[model samples]
Target chain A: MSSRREILDLLRENARYTTEDIARQTDFSVEEVAAAIEDFEEAGIVRGYQAVVDWGAVETEDERVRATVELNVALDRETNYGDIADRIAKFPEVTSLRLVSGDYDFDLEVEGDSMREVSHFISDKIAPIPEITQTVTHYIMESYKEQGMEFGDRDDDDRLSVSP
Target chain B: MTFEPADRVDQVPPSGIRRFFELAEEMDDIISLGVGEPDFTAPWAAREAAIASLERGRTSYTANRGKRELRERIARFEADKHELPYDPDEEILVTAGASEGLDLAFRALMNPGDAIAVVQPSYVSYVPDAIFAGAAVVDVPTRSEDEFKLTRDVLESSGAAEADALVYCYPNNPTGATMTGDELAEVAAFCREHDLVVFADEIYADLTYEHEHTSIATLPGMRERTIVFNGFSKAFAMTGFRLGYAMGPPEAIEAMNRIHQYTMLSAPTTAQYAAIEALDSCWEEVQEMTSQYDRRRKYVLSRFEDMGIDCFEAAGAFYAFPKCPWDDADEFAEALLQEEGVAVVPGSAFGEGGSGHLRVSYATGLPDLKEAMSRMESFLE
Candidate 1:
């Protein structure tokens, strides 16, 4: 990818980069940097900054169970994967769905209140479709880091009062 | 209000750099490339330590030489990082920052009328501070033709051999020139031959780009004669926290403490504790910042070269000393600021032989550096 595209992708992860920092990495003129960022924002090419939430933080409260399901599907001129993929995306429990390469054509990240519920949703609701040829589901055992945040050690309150 | 310093203090010509800053303050759109401090915040680990200290009510005054535990940490840190060996209990005096440490060292070492040999194109404080300490300054110009190196030839030709002491800043300010251990061993040998004491400011030691920074004190027979001044300002980005230390022979440290205890009783107690944490765990942060600085340094130097400007390629520190294509730095700098709204310090602010150059700092982030370079491109053309 071009550096500008990479810059936007990096921005998606962290917006703390000053224009000077970006210009250095991107080999762009600092004079034109602010305008470029402004263009990105004004044209809705860039949206807003956000925190990447770790579902594990609130996992206990919701009894959240997440599973990654990989599927190999039949493809030809008569039908396309996008047709069924879009339909599968409408399910509220599916957090993310991507058309991947290799043996599996699609991978769906699904969440549910329990493993039994997720099992039921995948087996009873998704597999009965005509397009599906094979299915595989894997449950996440642990998350050491999520969305660029490290969670190895428990975090403590960091704020302190100022003393003169 | 009585506003009077010792009459001698009034004569320490104010920094020419400050004058350029006056113009910068008046302009709202100025893109500056003239800060000496790092653009990064203190790392989270270091800040976390300070917060922890404050929570424990660590706001009281520390020892005159700072907390013993901190001193030990400083000793270990220096030993581990630079192969410097000093007795922490007797040899380290933690000051407010390198600024205060420099002041203390000067006041402690200089007798009235003593001469201090200082390199030209040096830090602004060196000449003025030496003057304030009631010492005569022997200016030895380090030339761009010679890569801004203060060689034994420059020292001898300038009659600096007769001076009572010498000050050297490696990974130098304004120029960013650094020396190898072999080169410094030769200089250290010269200092020994002349019976000159050395104040080696290694504040920029952690920011060296392509080379390993060699501390002069590490050379044979030099440790006893050299006081290495370093702190948390540049390395750990703890400038406002005001943590610094001086390490040397026990007598020199004691001499400095005599003056230090009377003037400034202690460095910030909380900062002392925080610095202990910094010395222990902030190496990764320092490495990260140094890498960022190294990248910026390469880009800035490449841009200067691409412009066909003659620049001394500095392997250490975060400054680019580039010759201005003009008659004098002050006029050229003023014109650039007025015409392009870019602010940089005139090299003349440094010292003699600095007239045709400008000091551009890469301590600022890259975009500002890029903007400054682009503006200078048009300004120079």
Candidate 2:
């Protein structure tokens, strides 16, 4: 009865934990957890587990700039936004895409080596799309929290317990 | 002859729940529904205060009674939340945990051969703590048929009327049973008539659902004789912080504080600061966590009903005690673990009255809880 999504959530939180530990947390047997994880791997529900990196902290000459580009689109009568969403998703620079319910019809997160490179990609590549109307790009200044995790934080949880 | 400890200590059995946990430790890959701790962490404001205090190097102990500001806030909190006014300086002793608070209260109040009536299917600490303090524990079974209320009739029938003091836990552990104010007023009347001191463990007070928790101390003529225990562990999700407090008349608080000073010295200073911050601003977090638990509770109960298992709907705490048709609780618990890799505490661990039942904690994630239910259904079928 445990959902594939729940198992994925646990792996997302801490992938290094053992199958036994995951089972203890998720109420699945080790065999069941192992099987579900195997199914996830086969079905592509999980691609890979990797550490989230902060290049600003480690890299000496990091020049990467990322921006969220909101697109106001005119949906065609045939495939309303699907064709455009597919085309946008195909871009290597696009990190995220969502059909949002705000002033914009689609949201795309794009990254580049510099601001100029990003603007060039938008104006040269994206502006040519016939169904698109307007594009507003917002550059991310810094990230304090991402994916429900606080960055650059000290480990503070394992101390001060006398009982359960 | 070897140096010997007190015979009474040897006479009492180790907690039935302890054996299962020890067994669980020897293996891996078991999904545990037996853990009593909350799944949430202490809220951010509280954690921030603790971090700030550590950076400021405030690691030294506070006064034996605890920090003045924390005690003052607790006093105000009591008055505001429970309508029971307590003098901050004279009537509260902060302990390392509710466990220590219970230990201190028992040692401070019990005389050898004194009798303490403890409700069964209750928290695990009361009986052994009383025994260690040289008191005889009288079992007062709060039958499931009665929805787990310890009424005057239940007390009298179980010989609890003869006891000198009573230990009561509402929003009770294991069973998740709670008593309404009208129900507790009857207990207040009975204790008054029988001249019994009441030890009220309200640790789960803030976790109450659908009904407000009623502290017996606020009942007429009960404040002077009732010793109330509460802590941040359950509501504020600060179990690891190790801070809890006992509130009572000045004499009882003084006795508990004397024991507290000797054994624990003081609760960790960083934790005290964290607790003070939590006390001030963690109500919103408490509400969010409580509502999440409510959703899980309803879901679990509905799952049980769908499976046609008999489960008593709980309005307090995070546990659900369901009656199983199995003849032996320990056997069922063991079989479930062996066959399905799912672990739950047998009801017999709570007390003899809890035999033939099982206690499941909804403090776990929803997916796993659902998995456990399916496992149970398959096992039962």
What's the CA RMSD for each of the models?
9.9, 8.9
Q: What C-alpha lDDT do the candidate models reach, one value each?
A: 0.83, 0.84
Instruction: Give the poorly placed runs of model 1, Cα more than 4 Å off.
Output: A1-164, B1-3
Looking at model 2, give its docking quality level.
incorrect
Candidate 1 chain B weakest ten by summed lDDT = B28-37
Pairs that collide, model 1: A20-B366, A20-B367
DockQ of each candidate's interface versus the true one?
A: 0.07, 0.07
For A18-134, candidate 2 gives per-residue lDDT tens digits of: 675566544477798899999989988888888776656666675889899989989768767889999988999998899999798999999999999999999988878888999
lDDT digits (tens) for residues B247-353 of candidate 1: 99999999999999999999988788778888888889898788678767767887887799889778787788888878777898889888998877888888866
| RMSD to native, candidate 1 | 9.9
Error of model 2, residue B336, in angstroms: 0.6
> What's the lDDT of the predicted structure labeled candidate 2?
0.84
Q: How well does candidate 2 match the true structure in TM-score terms?
A: 0.77
lDDT of 2 by residue, B181-272 (tens): 99999999999998999999999998877688999999999999999999889989898898999999999999998888888889889999
